[model samples]
Target: SDIFGEIFGGGRGGRSTVFRGADLRYNLEISLEQAAHGFDTKLRIPAMATCESCKGSGARPGTAPTTCPSCRGAGQVRVSQGPFSIAQTCPRCHGSGSIIPHPCAQCAGSGRIKLQKTLSVKIPSGVDEGDRVRLSGEGEPGVNGGPPGDLYVQVHIKPHPVFTRDHDDLHCEMPVSITSAALGGEIAIPTLDGSAKIRVPAETQSGKTFRLKGKGIKGVRSQAPGDLFCHVVVETPVNLTERQRQILREFDAISQQDSARHNPRAKGWFDKVKEFFES
Candidate 1:
């Protein structure tokens, strides 16, 4: 049935005379901060618009199109062979059912012209990458009398330098001095809003994660703000002076006197290694 319809130049009900326009797609890039907070921007698009000189009729000014003589305005022609009747588009009118005796000079009988259009776009908050924003009736102009198609704007978020985002949560690695990690202290950390302080417990180990509540992004559908996780990384001292080296050596000697109390993790690993070797 579909093949017959194609050969006859007719669809399920009949041949459609109206022409529908094609949809347009555009990719828009925005910053992560802008994605967190909504913003408005303008975009330029290259598309097709109906010709003004001919009023989309493809005919010259003050002249009207005439019905195609081949199909008698039916836009299709039929051929009979034996017991079969094959119908196809009228070659003279090319399925338009009319012929422009004097074509429009502007669009050269195409009924449309290329144009550059400027449009304003509004991005909603918490819009993630690959999200699409639709603008109704903003695509290429329709042919004949059909309505215009829609425009789709795809979203792309730029990478952030200081932090990595996961949905609404945020993660960052904070470097701390070895002494600070051992003795415990307060350190200033960066947040989306501003700088905040986090307290490190005494004997805090490297790679410990501290959660800062309500410091992350507040998504569009979220009831409460997400959390910011700071992963502590103990930094080893480098480029020590003569006096600092001597003091560290003395401190190391004092620490070795009670390895179990000062470095319980190292002592436990050594005990495990000894047991593995004996076994």
Candidate 2:
């Protein structure tokens, strides 16, 4: 049996036709702050659109298409092979069940042409890296009377410099001068918005974390802003002059006279070690 033939073995033709189209994809990159806050961008895409000259009819100017003679108006043809009788697509009409003797010059017989379209896309807040922003009905145009496909926009966020972000909290290292750590003073700390001063207590130790409330990123779903954690790193004295070195040595000598008074923990630990040896 042939692919196309006269329906009911009479005038040429068939039943209904099936048409499908193609889909499109795009990649978009945004900043971390933009992803956290949300923004809109424009996208230019190349796709196929229905031919204007033929208005998607695919017929020549001033000429109309004729119903397929092989499949009548149905689009499918029935054939008998050996002991089997089955339905096949009509070749003459290519399942469209119509024929244009004088096809449109612009699109030939396809009914669509290449074009470029610019579209605006909106980005939602709190969308992290590798997130996808979908735009429905924004892909390539459909084929021969079929529905159009979809467009997908994949998102990527750039890295920040000063602060490191976790889920919502921001982490940063803050250096404190030796005097600030020992005698206690105000030290400036960095935040997303601006610099802030934190009071350092006397004898403050290194690796202590100070939290600033409402200073970190605020997600779209969060009720309150996340916290900013500042880890203190005590800075040692450098470029000491001869007089400064002598003063430091005298201070150390005074503290060493009574270890039990200046360094009670060290004296207690040594006593415990001696007792352990005797036992």
Candidate 3:
């Protein structure tokens, strides 16, 4: 019986439709410390708000909407097709069964206005990059007072000067002196909590990894915290004095006598190159 309305009318059965507002996304950048411990901040966003001038009625002050004259409040009109009659939405009121003779000048009959609103947002701890925090009913105001949408806050951790994140683990390059790598020493590494120390064993090679347990972030759903990995990079001595240069030269000669034992990786690489060339 109402198939004609579904086929020809703009809405269902010529009745006015209510619509939920649009959802919105916001990218939020936070420091690693802030992300690790959580923080509260205020955000000012641009959105549509209900018009105060018309009280969402879209009618001018001291006036009200009047019933549609074309449909006589039935919200529908009829057209004759041979011997059959088909119902369609009223052209005058557009199926609202009413008309505003004086539209509010401020809103231009939109019943809403563009404005900025400030909202307090709480960031939960352990929110990794790409995570979304949803705030219900905080998006654009609904159409016809139906329902509002949601606001999604996307998490993006700002780049840290000393650390890089990987899921729950954190990684950092620790520069050690050539003397420290050769003779072994204790080095202090940075963690989210603070600084911690790791012992470098004797003859420690460059690119050695030292892991600190429970020094990384704990995820939102994780039962235990992650680890922090410290990659060792042996740094060469620069601006050497004449005596320093002479001492290094003597040490190099001593190491050269037993290069295979002192520089095993370089010896192995040279051996591989020699075999490849000979073959």
**lDDT agreement with native, every candidate:** 0.85, 0.78, 0.86
Order of quality (lDDT): 3, 1, 2
| Model 3 Cα shift for residue 220 (angstroms) | 1.3
Clashing pairs in 3: none
Residues 87-136, model 1: lDDT tens digits: 77779888877888999999898889999999999998877778899999
Worst 10 residues of 3 by lDDT: 8-17
- Candidate 2, residue 116: lDDT: 87
Q: Candidate 2 at residue 257, lDDT?
A: 97
Q: Which ten residues in a row have the lowest lDDT in candidate 1?
A: 8-17
Task: Return the TM-score for each candidate structure.
Answer: 0.86, 0.65, 0.88
Runs with alpha carbons beyond 4 Å of true place in candidate 1:
1-16
User: For model 2, how does the per-residue alpha-carbon lDDT over 1-279 read when each residue is reduced to its tens digit?
Assistant: 343333334333232333555667788888767876788888988878889999888898788888888878667676777665666767888677789999999999677888889989998876666767778877766655667778888887677776777767889888888778889999888776779988989888789999999888777567777899999999989999999999989988998899788768778999999999999
Summarize candidate 3's per-residue lDDT along 46-164 as a digit string, tens digits: 98888999998889989988878888776888888886667777889888777899999999887899999998899988889999889899998887767999999999999999999
